[model samples]
Target: MRLLTQLVWVFTVLAILLAVVLLFTYDVIKVEWISFMEIQPSHRQMEDPLPVPARSIPIEGPVSIPGMLPPENPVEADEASIARGSELFEIHCRMCHGQTAEGNGPIAPFLANKPANLTSPIVQSKSDGSIFLTITNGVEGKMPPLNENLLVHDRWDLVNFIRTLTIED
Candidate 1:
């Protein structure tokens, strides 16, 4: 009978403890953001407020392209210029246009639009300006812009090089 009373007392204490914990914990409100009493300025904001005066940059040599290179100068159909253009073409363009300008490169088969044949008489008939324009602003869904990669003078050199491919020596 004494043991039974002791068990009842223990159970009663446990129930009271649980009820007190629940009361304190239940429907608890949480605070997230704390409003700062003081504000700190960033490095830029803390620095000098006066604007520095602009100065002119002097040009010493031939100016290069700002972002996209201008076309290369068109040279005569000489062996040396053609050779130089050929080298440039091989490095930059041959991957897409082919080694012989035949519209057949490794990537040619995979391209949705095949590369143009530079040696075609039809291609030769087109004005240099037309070719240069095409090289500068590539055909939509066909070619990418060379202006970003090649200068204006280089494009003209490429054109001269292409002409050499078609014309007899």
Candidate 2:
């Protein structure tokens, strides 16, 4: 009983000494550190008003996306093109878009923004051109620019793959 009492007293004294040291030993104490909530270029600041490089012929010839076709010629979606697009989608898009194109892939939870549910009717309503543009340029918070990672043909293929996600009522 006496030994236990002595041990308790020793611990109490040590804790008190430590608390006093921490209180006085520091030359300066800051309650909070300076921080920045947002530290990136805004959308307006990043926008480019200048004209981009002129277009060249695509490898497979004129392709059509729903909203982006030239007024004179509208190309139809071919089976071969869609098949190619599916291949590219599996290779580059499956990891984030899911193997079924459901937008519930393994990496979805960790992303700063959720991937779009491509199967939605609203997305399906968009023209192929709009889909192609989104694939090429990406949505501000949802997708990333895949142009560098994928060739122009591959991007077209991805557009077709997105088309396949639309369920016909």
Candidate 3:
């Protein structure tokens, strides 16, 4: 009887200890160890970000439809268009393509693949449509696509500006 009583007492203590431990592990007791990561900003997986900026999509139509030939340059390369392209180039392309589009921008050195020489024959030989498509869909890994960053008209304008860049011998 004494042995049985002892065994029962030990078993009851162990069961109570296990239950208490489970309560904390399962968060039943509300005791939690806060982590530093919890305080930092985090985005949930597959969470949609803010809606695309206004005018990002032109009402006219899509700039370049895939599986088809590159679209022709719709925006004329007039002085005004060139001027706007110059300004956009300075703001966006200058960081990578440099002021003269010579692939020697201040940030070019840091990139794994150097920016292409816009004035080179290899670049100039391409059609205006090809250039526009490149800007819309960036050279993978080497450059980021400007589809969302620049309007359709602006891409054409930039392509026009690129045509004017020539190597000064």
Best by lDDT: 3
Flag clash pairs in model 3: none
lDDT of 3 by residue, 1-169 (tens): 9999999999999999999999988988885578887886666876754565765755758776668998888787899999999999999899998988999999999999999999988889999999988898799988988876788888888988888887544
> How many clashes does each candidate structure show, in the order listed?
10, 9, 0
Which window of 10 residues has the lowest lDDT sum in candidate 2? 68-77
After superposing all C-alphas onto the true structure, candidate 2 shows an RMSD in angstroms of 12.9
Candidate 2 per-residue C-alpha lDDT over 40-154 given as tens digits, one digit per residue, 9 for 90 to 100: 4434655654343468545655444446552221334578878888888888777787877777778888887877777877678887767776777788877886765677666
For candidate 3, what is the TM-score? 0.66
| Worst 10-residue lDDT window, candidate 3 | 48-57
Model 3 gets an lDDT of 0.86
- lDDT for predicted candidate 1 compared with the true structure: 0.71
The list of candidate 1 runs beyond 4 A from truth reads 1-74, 167-169
Model 1 agreement with the true structure over 56-164: per-residue lDDT tens digits: 3323223234465553444566777677778878987898889888888779999999998877777788877677778877888899867656776677777778777
Local accuracy by lDDT, each model: 0.71, 0.70, 0.86
lDDT of 2 at 31: 42
* Root-mean-square deviation (CA) per prediction: 13.7, 12.9, 8.8
